[model samples]
Target: MKTAVALTIAGSDSGGGAGIQADLKTFAFNYVHGASVVTCLTAQNTKEVTEVMAVSPNMVKAQFEAVINDIKVDALKTGMLFNQEIISTVADCIKSWGGDNIVIDPVMVSRTGAQLIDDSAVEVMKRELFPQALVLTPNIYEAQLLSCMSIHCLEDMKQAAAKIYDLGAKTVLIKGGAAEGKNKGIDVFFDGQGYTIVGIKAIDTVNNHGTGCSLGAGITAHLALGKSLPRAIASAKEYVTTALEYSLEIGSGCGPIGHFFPLIESQYNG
Candidate 1:
């Protein structure tokens, strides 16, 4: 039997915590083959992103065509679509290739407080890419930007989730990772009919450099493996929580969650 394949169209995180690194790791964890089309490259460490260089829109298109023409993608997700042109390019590619299950991670800002996306691209994403999304996952900050609603509390979260759903996404996962530290990490998933809150006690780990990318990738991985939307997201949160728990200290500043920790544990402990 062949392993199902998933593609991640995102940037390359030289720090190895996020972007293509996280997506590829998450796909492997979920027992799927992973491929990538780099959208940009960043000079980033756990502490800060010093620089970014986006791929040409034409190059992006070429890469996508090269992959799909050769391999079948069971599921796909996008992250860090920086500018309006790239946003338009990717949106067109998705439609032209006839995408399968797609998870859109509205990545606006980085964990280090750096801006990974352009202000103008946000509108293009909503108008072009989001309507075709199977599931849209946004962290609290991104949710606020998308819905124009301040999410200071859980009630605000439910409202934000509903509004984002109305924004044309078939489903929305508004990750509650940034509420007051006293509150747990509760990610809310709202489909058209109802909602669910998958909560995990906040892990006080500085090695959480790529939580957003990891979660979105994990969710896409589950979808590729035949899980329903709800199951995929719930399972993804669990996967990231475990990754955070076993996270390692690598860089001088922050660090990365171990995507293959489970595999490492199994190999060493057994």
Candidate 2:
């Protein structure tokens, strides 16, 4: 039997908790073969991100060509394209290759309220990349930015999801993990027709550094394994929730969710 293949085009996290590392771990946990195209490198830990450097557009394009040329990627996801040039380069590569089952995790703002991408990059992402996405997953902060509205309730999330869906994503998932009150952990999914509210039990943890990236990669892996878009989203949500439940307490600050939680559990169970 052939293993399903999934690709991640994102940044490198020195902390090994997010970006390409997290995406690969999530893909592996889903039983998919993972490929990667690194667009940037970050000197970051659970504590803070100190520095970041984007790969040149030429190198980013080269990486994409090398990966997609040999491997048959059943699905792919993008995360943390830090600049306009990288975003445009990736978009062109996706167009040249084929945009099928592409999950775009708009990594504009961090969970710590820091902006990761510049405004120009955001514009390029929406204009060049979003329309090609099969699924666009944005956290509450990113959703607010994309939709130009504040999200404080489920209704607000729904509206934001709808508004973002208009921007050309076939489906939009507005993650409400950072929401307050009764809306926390309740995500709104909009697929141009109606809305579905996806909610899971909230896990209280400061170790959620890679939740967004992992979720997007999980969905891509599921898609590679032949699940429908909505089904993939549902499965990814469950995977992230479980991973969060077993989040690792590493470093002096916010840790990361356990992408390989099942394997870690088996070490103890056995």
Provide the overall lDDT of each model, using Cα atoms, as 2-decimal numbers: 0.87, 0.91
Candidate 2 lDDT tens digits, 1-270: 999999999999999999999999999999999999999999999998899998999999999999888988999999999899999999999898885889999999987667877888899999999999998999999998999998777888889999999999899998877887778778889999889988888888888889889989999999999999989989999999999999999999999999999998999899
Summed backbone clashes in each candidate are 0, 0
Candidate 2: residue 79 lDDT (0-100): 95
Worst 10 residues of 2 by lDDT: 110-119
Q: Where does model 2 exceed 4 Å of error?
A: none
What TM value does model 1 have? 0.96
Candidate 1 lDDT over residue span 110-162, tens digit each: 54335556677888999999998999998888888878888788878899999
State residue 249's C-alpha deviation in candidate 1, in Å: 0.6
Worst 10 residues of 1 by lDDT: 109-118
